[model samples]
Target chain A: MLGEVEVEVYAEVKPTESEVKVKRAVLNIIELDELEVIDVNGVKYIHGKARGLSYLSRIRDLIRRERIRDTARDLLNHSVVGDEVVINVNKQAAYVGVLSFAMGEVESPLGPITIRIKSSNPQQLIMWLTSG
Target chain B: MLGEVEVEVYAEVKPTESEVKVKRAVLNIIELDELEVIDVNGVKYIHGKARGLSYLSRIRDLIRRERIRDTARDLLNHSVVGDEVVINVNKQAAYVGVLSFAMGEVESPLGPITIRIKSSNPQQLIMWLTSG
Candidate 1:
């Protein structure tokens, strides 16, 4: 049984970018209980935190709509390290309400929206996310 | 005489960036009379407008401080098209109050801060900007 889920999302705001739009891009993918902009060193980042699998409903729907269940499942499977799974999506694509997997940090010129999920049962969480 | 100068500063706000920092980046290089964020084709951009050479005082100072007068002059010379001179600077560097020229749009992963300046006397403007 999946007991509890914790999620964290981060996106770097380039000096040329708007905080409001970056927030929208993150919200477009997943709902967060807390969201704010924080400066790490000299770089500004959009940080989001939430608890429970309910917040990931939009991401689950996106995978289904985009017909990437197999790809997403593989990605999630490989990303699982103990109790956590990490996913990166293109920020530009997310802003337009689309989910595009970023294979690496350099996949997008503006960087990716990094999503981290921790669950009591990561296997079950992955099953629930990718399963029809 | 340079007469009058019109300057427009623009930077794209990526989803992960803070508007305040981006504004700081632009202000670090030049002063603007009006600055705001506007949505263009669903993309957010920092738009700035100013008039007169006084607004460009910071940029001129930066050129002298960085000792890039020769290089800056060459860039300004090449960028001159009609009555306008265009320059692109790395936004990240600008945020930290440093002026680094962007050779191309792809020079920075987050894109560059594009500056457009129109002057009644482009030759005089260039000389005033680069000359000691």
Candidate 2:
């Protein structure tokens, strides 16, 4: 669990009219990565991550391929919107299966950044992500 | 776990300049509940909950008083933004301690509604919620 941490999340905002329409749906994705995770002692700060247009386009291909299906299925079948799914990446190996739930890399002032996808039907979005 | 379901999440947008500032921060809360969860077999659709302005003010007291500290602590100390925190509520009572993680009641066309709060330091917000 990355307690007191922040990560970018992306989900296709609109659903495709058809299985074929999933591509269009993928275009309407909304990302909310604007909160930072500095020490949680005093002042709480919030800001959006500085990701660019080219990165969004680049990730479209990754989403289209369904690389995150296992992780999506885990989230969809087990949790809801407000629920937290902790992914541990260090040596202790807290959880198994998918070590990386993050989406494609994007450039940021913090250096390269990645995002996790949060959705109502994360599994269904996997279909949309991999569909067309 | 409310799998295959959608729920609204709210969090204060700004931090208070002082301990007194938390009140002002509480006023700048942002909500993103514009999503609907129909069966995930086909045609995905998205829409916002038609909650009214009165309800937002109504919940402000709940946020101010820190009614959700236990739940927020559970989240802040354990999960990250992208992780899903599955909360089970029902006759079975799979998860205990705080049975109601929801903030407060609000009217919606779907009937009365409730929201969960998501933030970088959900625990600290709990402090603000209970502070002054």
Candidate 3:
């Protein structure tokens, strides 16, 4: 069970990309209670935050539907550090409502959607997310 | 003076990319009299067509403003084949209203905006476009 978990999603809006589409890509994976567009040194980013693990239901559903539980479990285990579980998913895939994990920036040309979850018990959260 | 010329512009709308932004990137460089979105299989492309050399005025002006005449002249000359002149411009740059030439797809992550011009006298058109 996830306890006192805080989820943060972030995606960059490339100069050639529309901000709306980028936000849609993020929303397709997680439901954020608060979302905002922030600019840093002329570059724009879509940032969103939500409380609790319920926001990640869409991703859990996709992983089960795609039958990528093993892959997701491995990725989630590797992503765990300290009290955070950070994972990157393919933005293009997410745009079309698919949850494809990306190893790095190369996998997604527009860059990956970064999801960071801070929980009191990271291992338990990862176990729940990748569990069937 | 460029005689009757036909211009065609195209940009792909990647799964993660917005079609409207792709169209805007094309329009930022050349003025198209007719524009359409076509789907080849499941992939979508923004295609536009126009007549006369006036459609290329913005590119010419940008080349002059950016002081890339020599580079443009060289690129234009190399792009000539028979009566057709083909050039690729950085889509990100175009979106920002700048005219930066791209050699190939590598230059633009979303793919470059392709501009093709067919004229009876390609050399003359190239001369006028690059000349002060």
Best by TM-score: 3
How far off is residue A91 in model 3, in Å? 1.8
RMSD (CA, Å), each prediction: 3.9, 21.6, 2.3
Instruction: Point out where model 2 deviates above 4 Å.
Output: A1-132, B1-37, B42-60, B63-76, B79-99, B102-126, B130-132
In order, the Cα lDDT scores of the candidates are 0.88, 0.30, 0.86
TM-score for each candidate, following the candidate numbering: 0.72, 0.20, 0.88
Model 3 misplacement above 4 A: B1-4
Query: What C-alpha lDDT, on a 0 to 100 scale, does residue A35 get in candidate 1?
Result: 88
Q: Which of the numbered candidates is closest to the native, going by highest lDDT? A: 1
Q: lDDT (0-100) at residue B123 of candidate 2?
A: 43
- Best candidate per DockQ, number? 3
The DockQ scores of all candidates, in the order shown, are 0.38, 0.01, 0.59
Candidate 1 CAPRI-style tier: acceptable
Interface RMSD of each: 3.2, 20.5, 1.7
Ranking by lDDT: 1, 3, 2
Rank by DockQ (best first): 3, 1, 2
* Clashing residue pairs for model 3: none
For model 3, how does the per-residue alpha-carbon lDDT over B15-42 read when each residue is reduced to its tens digit?
Answer: 7677777788888888787679999898
